[model samples]
Target: MSNLLKVIALLSLTVAAPGQSQADWQSHESILGAILEQVESNLRHTGEKYQIDVAPLDRRLQLPQCDRPLTVARLPGTRDLGNISVSVRCEGTQPWSLYGRAFVRLSKQVVALRTALRQGSLIAPGDVELVEKDATSLHGGFFNPEDVIGKPVRKSLAAGTVLLPTHLTTVKLVKRGQQVAIRAQNTVFEVSMAGIALTDGEAGQRIRVRNVSSQRIIEGQVISDGTISVSP
Candidate 1:
């Protein structure tokens, strides 16, 4: 009877203890780190320089080890670059999901004035410099230096101030009452006419013009400094 009892004890030990049936599962840290790495890689693919800050998951929280590699993805409609949430999931038999938040600080090279600029001062390459700035912080910031060059400032701006789209006018390509060559084009054919602009317009902007020969008012897009186009 004692031998039988000893044999039963040995059998219990050999059968494996409860909760030790499978390999140790992944820790919360490892899973969270994997998710963060995927998020960083996705952000980098956008081609914008950014400093990423991912909020850490609760250190004490327990997570089951995934037999397969864990999958990480951004939540739908969470495409914005600022504070955002991502989904981390394990597709194994013990499936689980969690949301992680990340703060992405995007940076860009934006145009900034090198010298104090007064209202009506024309912007030149020499007067502006491309400076690295927090992209999210600058509302309506100007990116292309050429877009602002030759544009007159609408308000006085201090030296080193970041340029905004609202601070400059679109360089006027056609002036009111100026004679402009009007070109009408389509897939089939092209035609040209002489017209007088009745309203000022920048390149690609629609403006009112009068046909010089017909004396009929028409709307056309300013194609260049001295040219406009109308659809027939």
Candidate 2:
């Protein structure tokens, strides 16, 4: 009789152990899911529509069941888009912390080459077209077609490739050893002179030039093709 009682007690504990573990697993998933949903909600409220992808929780990790709701927060310096991680914590008697990764994608219209482009090719309105793309994964693509029009390609790009700042450059306006107009202005007066450019420069770039009349070397910003402006 005594042996039978002992065996029944052991069997009861064995059956109840698995039930408790299952409950803990469910609680763990609930907490992690809530944290990821918060991350998605925050991204959606940024005024831009985003498609969020969250990684699945590791099945091997077992967390204790919490009687209270879990606390979720973004890691320090986290942005609203791209791949990021969030921290989740349980503040109940059995406390725990975890980090989860999520990917946020925003759709944007960007400029891409309609056909294969060669290095030094001038970008024309017909050569590029606007296409909807994932802005987060563009790796810094040019969104405005106007910003790239007339710019020279720095390297060859394949068809359907997005244009990036590193892929294009402004046309050089001031070539080395060329004569250019130098304009100087002050609060009271303005002056113009002829100067020879010592270095090649594009519009908005600063370059060195020698004034023809004064025989003075000066640094000025290239304002246009064959034109440089110096401060008074």
Report RMSD for candidate 2.
8.9
- The deviation in Å at residue 32 for candidate 1 is 2.0
Which residue pairs in candidate 1 collide? Answer: 26-65
- How would you encode candidate 1's per-residue C-alpha lDDT over 1-232 as one tens digit per residue? 1344334323322222357533554566676687678768877676878877777655434456677888888878875567777767778766666666778788889999999999989998899999989876767787888978888999999999998878887678899999999899999999999999999998789999999999999998888888998888
Where in model 2 is the C-alpha error above 4 Å? 1-29, 45-47, 58-62, 75-83
Clashes of each: 1, 0
lDDT for 170 in candidate 1 is: 63
List TM-score per model, in order.
0.75, 0.76
lDDT of each: 0.78, 0.79
Candidate 2: which pairs clash?
none
